[model samples]
Target chain A: MATNRQIVLDNRPDGEATTSNFKLVTSETPALADGQVLVRHHYLSLDPYMRGRMNESKSYAASQALGEVMIGGTVGEVVESRSPKFKPGDQVVGMGGWQEYSVVDADAPGMLRKVDTTHVPLSYYLGAVGMPGVTAWYGLVKIINPKPGSTVVVSAASGAVGSTYAALAKARGCRVVGIAGGPEKCRYAVEELHFDACIDYRVHGDVKSMSKALKEACPDGIDGYFENVGGYILDAVLLRTNAFARIAVCGMIAGYDGAPLPLQNPTLILINRLTIEGFIVSEHVEVWPEALKELGTLVAQGKLKPRESVAQGLQAAPEAFLGLLKGKNFGKQLVKLI
Target chain B: MATNRQIVLDNRPDGEATTSNFKLVTSETPALADGQVLVRHHYLSLDPYMRGRMNESKSYAASQALGEVMIGGTVGEVVESRSPKFKPGDQVVGMGGWQEYSVVDADAPGMLRKVDTTHVPLSYYLGAVGMPGVTAWYGLVKIINPKPGSTVVVSAASGAVGSTYAALAKARGCRVVGIAGGPEKCRYAVEELHFDACIDYRVHGDVKSMSKALKEACPDGIDGYFENVGGYILDAVLLRTNAFARIAVCGMIAGYDGAPLPLQNPTLILINRLTIEGFIVSEHVEVWPEALKELGTLVAQGKLKPRESVAQGLQAAPEAFLGLLKGKNFGKQLVKLI
Candidate 1:
């Protein structure tokens, strides 16, 4: 039996997540069942939503249990297979979690899918051409649905989801404005992602100042918004939204630490006749095929280029994830487990 | 010359509006132009939305300018006509404001509409078969779109909009809940309006208590909410909402006085995947013909009954409006201008 390395959730965070909350363990891989396949993960996708799972609070997905493998998206290769469906050397994508190897039932519905990495890179499957990409597609197409020539603003502008959202909105003839934490990420969002403008939220001292900057960035008031990092930015956006504006609330990274993020002036929601909705992308399975096809094509054509902040080993995932929550990572935070 | 008793906006209120903010002025009714008519107002609609117009801040509609008749919905008789579209003794509904008479353009689109008072009472055109009735129809049918057998809650349950909304949702086979200011209104909501349950919001000391009451009232959790009072009640409802709940933001009467009504735990909006939308019914003109027809039919069949708290004369408009804002009126607040 081969040895497998796994990182488990050791404890729930008191406030901000730290490395102490995770535990690395070595164990022997169990013998394959009748319909099992062994997958050796090459890349593990680390996202802000993982922070939500670390806590015991009610979330879209189940919480990461103590002494269990931390849940994550992974692109890996099937090294051994007992089932005829998945053969050795076949690259696959699934919820392989934070581990060196995964024993998955090949017959399990929606547990794994084989990916063609001929044109698109295997790592892109964990980020741009995968869940994040599909998330952007669903929120933009289904929720926001910005009209041509309308303004759409996105938070966490240089991240996997935000970058893809900006690109998708821009392609639809929307004037895309991005809100980023620093100057570098803002530059990348505007220059590389082709966003019309980007605001460095860190430079603005308060919500009012940030609102002013956002107002300047979006000459026409925001008609749609893709919210990732909520709190002050959301309040500012509420103030700047035009009548009949729509907002797709994807994530509220600011409130993941269990801090109260009260919204001031909810009356604006009535005055502006705004429609705000929160959604989990996985819940909308019907759109996956359509969204993935467009995202895959965009990545293959280099039209949706996504950057990654790589961590060399599985041991670095905890730190990388913590850094991601703090906005330290430049783009998609990934653990190069191979 | 016919003397018109007009209630003008004297000064913008700094806090809560008072009768002093309005001035009863006597002016000669303007002569009918080639395409205009002189209307003798019989009843003026006093609504919660009127409170929003009393402030200088930006609202869905423009602020009522100082020294101008406070804008409102009114049903009256066309005493004089210059255009063939309208004639003497014809019953009509228009933006007749807080006055005994109005000079309106008969040919102006959306300025006036002739209504049948034979089947539905003339006052029904001001409450049940009119704007408030259409408001309930639009918010329920268009925005909330509650599924049959789902739970729906409406604030200001005994008021014009809420009473109509509760009745409408109940007629659609929904389990209807209502939040009213007092036990009297709560009784009216349940016994008269046919709500499944009603919460006396005044009896609940705080949001936590109110939320507990709401949870008890809505054992299945709230699927749809018609938000009329948007302060603590909105916060409470947010706590009690089920997944994918829809809220129609018709009015935020609590914040109309310029007090900050911050929403605590807006994160629930994300966690529950709620779709909250604020709408002004007038903006959706396309639905009027369909809505009015249905509303008129309901009123004619005695299926939708609305009560009125009628103030004696046009001079009583200011105090009635002020009382309406304070929850002093039992039902649809109206001024009998005749």
Candidate 2:
């Protein structure tokens, strides 16, 4: 019998999360039933949303129960298959959790997906051409719904979701502006990601300074905004928004640690007539085909050149994820489990 | 020529608005030019929105210009008309500001409207059938857009906008809840306005207690929220929102004094996947016909019964307005100019 290494939730965090909250255990792979497939994970995705799941409090997503394998997205090759949909050696992507191997019910809808790694690498499924890509599509296409020449801004500009969003917004003929933590990431966003401009939040720490930077970056004022990191960035964006701006609230990593993140000026929301909507990508599966198709096309056309920050092994996942929560990662944060 | 006594904005407010900020001025009403009509106002409407116009800061509406008449809604009689649409003895509504008489260009579309005071009282036009009623309709129908059984909550329960909103929600088969300043206002909302439940913010005092009261009042949780007053009321509502709730931000009287009002726990916005939209009713003129039609029907059917607090004369407008802002006025505050 093949043995599987898995990371399980050891305890819930009181304030800040640490690697001690997770426990790595080894167990024999369970025999697959009819219509099931065994997948040996090659890569595991680490996302900010995972931090929310690790909490015991009620949120949009279900909490990660103690003793259960940590929930995550994984891309791997099918080792064995009892279903007609998947054959042995098929490259697939699924929610395989934080594990070296996963047994999935292939017959269940959306349980597993076969992906072509002809031109795009399999790891992209966990990033640019997969969930994060779809996430960018939903917020930009469905929520923001900007017109051509409309000025749009995104926070955490060098991250996977922001990178995809920048590519998509640029394709729409929008004036894309980005806000990142450091000068290096900001420079990469403008030069590599082709963002029209990028503002370094670290250089301008307070709301007043950041607002001045935003105003200078977006002279026409932001018509649409994708909020990934809230607090000062959001407050700064609100100060520079034109009439009837739309904001898609994707993530607030600052508040992920359970600190009370107060919005400085909700009054600006009324004054500017803004529509701020919060959404989850998994909740909108109907946009998957269309979103993935465009994201795939962009990747194929080289319009979207995604960078990755890969941790060497499964044991490094907790640290990598913790670093990601602190904006230490340069791009998509993932752990190589192969 | 006619001598018109008016209240003009003497100066902008430094903090809380006071009578000293407004000056009682006398102006001559010039003779009606072609397509112009002379309106002798009977009642001048004092609304929370006017408080916003008092500030020099840019908001949804334009600032009330200094050394000019205090801009307000007025219901009056057309004294003379050169335009075919209006004539002598006709009751009408227009933005006549804080004055006894106004020379309006009647030919301008939506500048002046003739109303039938047969079944509906002329003063009701200043409250339920006019801008405030339409404001309520736009927030509830367009922004909130709740289903039949949806539980909707509105603040400023006994005010003109909140009263109308309750009736509209009830007619649509919704469970309508409200939050007002005092126990008297709360009782009036539940008994007179027929709200399912009404919480008194003064009694509850803070977010935690108000949230507990909201849990009991809105047992199913709020599906939609209409925010008229910001601060602790909004914070309390956020804690009791059901998944996918919609919020229509109408006003934030608490912030009109240029104080920085913050939204506590914006993380709840992401957790609840809520849609918080801010709108100005005057911006959506297309919805007016439909909204006004529904509002008029409800008023006629006795489903909507509006209350008003009228001061003796035009000179009392400044004091009456200050009272309205301080929540001392119980209903739609107006100045009887006749």
Candidate 3:
């Protein structure tokens, strides 16, 4: 029997998630079924959406039950295969939760991705080359459909999804401005990701002043807005949206721990003739092939680069998730189990 | 000089507008310039949007300046032409305001449209054949784009714009539901306008119950929402929108009378992947010719009928407008002036 270290949900927290909410324990893996493959986890992807799954609220997905292994995406090598589709030593990606080992059906919807890691790091498959990459692609191309020379603004600029959005919009000849929590991420966004400018929301006095700052930065007014943190930040951006602007509501990190009611700036949508849309990447899985192919090519050609903050071992998963929630992680927060 | 009886804005009201906000006075029309024409008002259209202009607050259009003639749309006859585009005895529709006679530049954007009253009543220009008709066309075809089997909900269903929207959506093969303040209008919307169902919001105890009633009416969930009375009705509709639903926001009568927020359904846009958009008919003039042609053909074929609530004389404009604001008018409110 192989020993598998798993991180379980200990308790649902009040406001922000803490280490006490998670517990780690080592257990023996159960016997795999006829079509199940035993995957040895190499990388775990920590995402903001996991915070939504922590609370017992009705959302896109059900909340994680207490004492159950916390769910997440991961990259792993097939150590043993009961199905002919996957062979021993073949590396793949799947929603394997936070564990050193997982037994999964080879043909599940979110089963796995075969990666040729010679060109890029295998972990990049969990970040820029994977979910976050597809998020930006589908949101910008399908939902927002930004025209050339359009002003696009992204919240949480240096994060995995924001970086992907900025690079993709820039490649399409759009003027992109990013908003981040601090100055360092702002600098990294402008200098590294090549965003036109980055606004430091932490230092900004208030939404009114920030609205003015955004108006000044986006002289043409915002044509496309990709919202990640959706509270007052959304309010500030809504005030500056141009006529017929399209807003893609990707995530609302600001309201993750709070009630989702009484949004401050809905009137701006009526006044400016704007279109506000909410979207989830998982809903468009059938059409995501084109987006993934494009992102994969961009990564192979070195045109798009994604940064990651890697936390090694299953014991570090809780801290990694907390860092992601606090916006401390520079880019994609990942836990390495190797 | 021609003597003109005009209704002027006497004062801005607190909650609901009343006759006290308007004063009737007789004035002489100014001498026409070289490029101007004199118009003799026949049918003055009293719309719900004018209520927004009565208050000294922000809207798409500037508020009525105190002690100034109330603004409105009217069907008039060109009594004298100083420009080649107009001739005497030509019946036309233009923005003649709330007055019996006025001077206008023949080349102005709101120039009169030639009338053909042989098949349909000329006042249809103010309701089904005019602004409301165009509003329905653009908001449905361009904004909402309801599918053949999609479910649609329209508030203020017996009013001009809402009635037109219900008829158009039903003709396009949609499951249409109308929401009105009274049982009489709701019955009219269902029996006369051919809406699939109708909901009387006034009888409902609260918005949550109203939302439940609306949801029961729309088993497939609302795919398109035409918002006329905003506030709580909008909030209820927002809570019930289906994925990828489209909302056409035309009016906010519920919030027009000093309500806190006009439309407060922000969460619906995100949770259901819905799109909410605001529009005005004036912005879509380029496509108005084709739209009007279709509406005219419908009326000429006797497939469409518009209801009119006629208030006699210029002195009745104030009471008629107040009745519209109070939701007392049965259908399209119009004041006879000729």
Ranking by lDDT: 2, 1, 3
| Pairs in clash, predicted candidate 1 | none
lDDT of 2 at A90: 98
User: Model 2, which residues run further than 4 Å from truth?
Assistant: none
**What docking grade does candidate 3 earn?**
acceptable
Q: What is candidate 2's DockQ?
A: 0.85
Question: What does the interface RMSD come to for each candidate?
Answer: 0.9, 0.8, 2.5
Q: For candidate 2, write residues A137-223 as lDDT tens digits.
A: 999999999999999999999999989999999999999999888988998999999999999988989899999999999999999
TM-score of each: 0.98, 0.99, 0.90
> In model 2, what is the error at residue B91, expressed in angstroms?
1.5
Q: What TM-score does candidate 2 get on C-alpha atoms?
A: 0.99
Pairwise TM-score winner, candidates 1 and 3: 1
Tell me the spans in candidate 1 whose CA falls farther than 4 Å from its real position. none
Worst lDDT 10-window in candidate 3 chain B = B259-268
Better of 1 and 2 by lDDT: 2
State the displacement of the C-alpha of residue B26, model 3, in Å, after optimal TM-score superposition: 4.4
Tens-digit lDDT track of model 3 for A51-86? 878988655446899999999999989998898888
Best by lDDT: 2
